[model samples]
Target: MAQVLEFKLPDLGEGLTEAEIVRWLVQVGDVVAIDQPVVEVETAKAMVEVPCPYGGVVTARFGEEGAELPVGAPLLTVAVGASAADTPGPGEVPARDGRQDPPASVNGNSRPAAADAPGGAAEGSGNVLVGYGTGTAPARRRRVRPAAPATPASSAPPARPSPVPPAPAPTVAAVPGQDASRGEGPVPVISPLVRRLARENGLDLRELHGSGPDGLILRADVEYALRAAAAQGRTAQAQAVVAAAPAVAEPQPAVPASAVAPGGTRVPLKGVRGAVADKLSRSRREIPDATCWVDADATELMRARAAMNASGGPKISLLALLARICTAALARFPELNSTVDTAAREVVRLDHVHLGFAAQTERGLVVPVVRDAHTRDAEGLTAEMARLTEAARTGTLTPAQLTGGTFTLNNYGVFGVDGSTPIINHPEAAMLGVGRIVPKPWVHEGELAVRQVVQLSLTFDHRVCDGGTAGGFLRYVADCVEQPAVLLRSL
Candidate 1:
């Protein structure tokens, strides 16, 4: 006798309510061990692998890949008791003329053997997380069926339980090599999710040739078809726009549809992109922000970096040196190292600096925060920043690493931009932007000289500080850049 137990999606924490099924790691009839990961799901915060706590044979799976399921929704069902190889498997279910008949008992009671007894408990891992635990297992005694009346020597064995699901009869209309568009046959798709995806995208399933086993259609094939359709539609629209433009005697090639098309493709802002959009929009809607910038002579700062590298402990990066400068500046002007509590209507001044820096990756722009950055030296900051950058690039950053910043440092110089009026990272009162360091002609002690100069921009919440405090912070940062020795006073 086996007990079928249902497993639901677990609470992934961090206030996430739903997740998109990225992939399935197990299938029906596969035996799984306790704590084995069964699926990969993508939440708004990160990609996570969910582990099943039950060690049993998978009987059925509820959702398909790419389906967005809410927390606590049924994930899968597992049959517990005996292994498939040890007991009668699903394929052994008795059938006559392709029709299943209930098992007959020797006493003619027709009762299952296991149901007559009680008080047998299935063992399970004591995992206490959502959708886990041993509490759901059945408590019953396993029973054996009595000998049945002798009939033919090859008579069917006594029926235990039906392990196999009923199979749908094959359609006679649709045969191999028949065109699906003619409605002669059913579309060959295995997963219901693939059918739903094609229907939602207005795709004609018959037109697509399945690349899976036995010409079975797959989800990836449907996605590829949608992409191709979208691309072709955009190309046609672009050509029409170009042809409609008035022609001059000497005409230039018409602008692309991406540049001039009335409406272009719209990508849904979800996941990391959506999180960024919400935060930025909130920052803009709620915070009264102001920007200030100044050009600093970084020749001495460059010289200091070269000297440090020459000393050869660990090669110090320019960003680390700037971070060291930022901590010192925040120390001098503590007003910018705080957030405004809107609910309390009070300015909350933070004592420690959890500095966040903007790093761009294939996913999107992410701010990886460094804890207690004010306590770290240049070498320490360099190591931590390098680790975070690599994690961001690989899309392995946890939610904790991406949050809880008291201030932000953005190095947009890597993009070759000279200046930008940056938006303050919300909840944090200020952000420091460092632009490109280029050789520019400047007066060095009243004499014109080519110096390594960098533009520094500061955006701050006006509610927390006035123009004077913001100016003082920016000026102190600039002084440190002009002469690295200025940082030694605070250090």
Candidate 2:
């Protein structure tokens, strides 16, 4: 006997609520091993390969590739303890009377067999995502069959429980301003993203019909309704303007057709792009920030780096040296290394520095944080940054590696640009921006000289520190650039 088990998508941590299916690794009727990678999904954070905990034959899969599924949605079903002859063929399902039948069962029961049952098929690897366990299976809901016409007592057959349970019907929540007379129940929406879209656009979910299974409202449905409504409104407004126009109006200059019907490619802000948009928007909205910049003569710093590499076992990167200087400067001006707690009305200074560096990848801009950066030396920081850069380029960074930074270092110089007032990474107090180091005319030791010059900008939250502190930090960094020995005093 085979026991059919349902496997729902587990919660990927770090406050992620949903994921878009990128690809499926297994197909129906494929025999799978425990903890095998089943599907690849892209969340707001990174690309992840989700593994199944059960070892069995895949019975069915839920969402198609490129479809977004909320957490806890069914990913697939597996039939455990089934013989090779019992497994259905690829893309085939057992049906009766031209209708699909419920899953097969074990021992006349719809639920999964106990973990200690024969063959121990119900036992799982217990390696699901955080907060999800496979120790015990959840109880199945009983399927509610429709009532049949009453028959004579002599002709009625003996009643027995169904072999497998049916999936529960979609539930809805009552929508405000809904007409009670229509007898419609609450709106059937399961995705928070769908609900947020409808709410933000003031579109009533009750007015639109869902095209998903069980009439569950999806994001596409709300988007289609909003688009149709906009087109209708535009049509009505155009008609009204034409009717109000005077019959003998003076002729006006002709407008370009391009202006009348604007056309261009529309790229959706989603996944990594969407997440970056939300964070940058929030930073601009919540932080009252200011920027200060200074030009530093970096001839000495470059020479020092060359000398170190020439004599070193492991080559030290220029970014790592700059990071070392930042940590040292923060130690002197600790106020810049803290965040503001608006709710508590306190400027909470952090005890340790988690330094984040901006790395642009094919996916988008990402900041990978290095934990306890204040404790690492230049070589260590270089190694860690290289590892993170590779991970970011390959789209394998975890959510934890992408968040929790107390300060940020953004080196836009690699782009061959000179100064920029960078927006602070929110919740953190400040960001340091470094620009290209080029040879330019400078007054050194009271004489004209050509030296390597780099521009450095510091953007700080005005609430945490005033212009005096920000200037001092930038000045210190400039001093270190001109004379690398100044950093040894702090060390």
Candidate 3:
């Protein structure tokens, strides 16, 4: 006997609620082993391959690729205790009463009815996602068939045919111009993507009739409704223009070019892009942040990097040197390396430095955190940073790698620009921005000389420290950049 088990999208951690199906690894009727990655999904944080807990034959897949499904929504169904030979062929399912029933397709994919095996127990891998674990399959409640009323033929009443034929029951699709408010209960919607589309376009879900099973609203139905509404609006506008035309012509005021132009391309802020927008927006809204900048002569820092690379060892990156300075400065000015706890009305200072650096990728801007940065030397920092940068570029960074930062070091200089007051990565107290090092005339030891100069800016949460503390931290970082020997005292 084969038992069908359902697998859902698991919690990917870090408060992520949903994910978009990127690709499916297995299809209907394919055999799978325990812990095999069944599907690849892109969450707001990163791209992840989700694994199945049961070893079985895949019976159905829930959503199509590119469809967004909430956590805990069904991802697929599997028939456990069945071999490849025992598994029914496509479009056929083993019935509960020992018969084969034709399978039905949902969203253009075949799905068989799920049922548990009688008196058969199946084991599963205990590891899935956080908060979900393996256990004995719960018994499924069976529906009891009601018995027909029994009566003697003589006692039974004879039925007569009615003069008028009976009317058909109302369907899921409501009649046009019908009052949506009059309908009872919740609207029939299963996919969150459909709801989001309707909400974004300001379309009321109640007003449109669904074309799916039992009047369930599908994505196609919502799109059709939106198109109809847009066409209706355009027609009304044309009618109004004709109605306003006058017999005696009066010159109309000139419309602005922006007003007359067609709408531009609209790129949805979602996934990584959406997450960045949300975090940056919250930082601006909640934290009272201030920025301070200073120009430092980086001739010595650059020379030190060159000297290290000249010696035969793993090449030291300029970013690693800056990160070393940041960690040392944070050690002295611990106030800048903490976060403000708004609810408790307190400033929570972190002991360890999980330093995050900004990396630009094809997807969007992502910050990958280097754990215990304070404990690592220049060489260690360089290796870890290189690994994280490669991961970010490949879109293989995990959620854990992207979060839990105490401070951020943003090297926007790679963009070839001189300086920018970077927006602080939120929840974290501060962010240090580094500009390009270029030759500039400066007073060096009482003489006007051309030296390598770089601009460094620090943006801090004002609640954590005052301007004097912020200025002191920036000055220390600048000193280290100018005279690499200044870092020796901390070491």
lDDT to native, each model: 0.69, 0.72, 0.73
Query: How many Å off is the CA of 137 in candidate 2?
Result: 18
How many clashes in each structure?
3, 0, 0
The 10-residue segment with the lowest total lDDT in model 1:
121-130
For model 1, name the residue pairs that clash.
118-141, 119-140, 120-140
For candidate 2, list the clashing residue pairs, or say none.
Answer: none
In angstroms, the error of model 1 at 270 is 0.9
Rate residue 484 of model 1 by lDDT.
86
* Candidate rank order under TM-score: 2, 3, 1
Which lDDT tens digits does candidate 1 get at residues 99-126? 2222222111111111111111111101
Residues 1-491 of candidate 3: C-alpha lDDT, one tens digit per residue = 87778897888999998887888898767899999999988888988889999999876566666656678766777789887677655545344443333333323222222333222111111111111112222222222222222333422222212335622212222333354442443454545667789889987666654544334566656765665555545555655666797453433323333335456665766678888999999999998999999999999999999999999899999999999999999999999999988889999989999999999999889999999999999999999999999999988899999999999999999998888887889899999999998999999999999999999999999999999999999999999999999999978
lDDT of 1: 0.69
Q: Pick the candidate with the highest TM-score.
A: 2
Stretch of 10 with least lDDT, candidate 2 = 124-133
Please give the lDDT score at residue 444 for candidate 2: 93
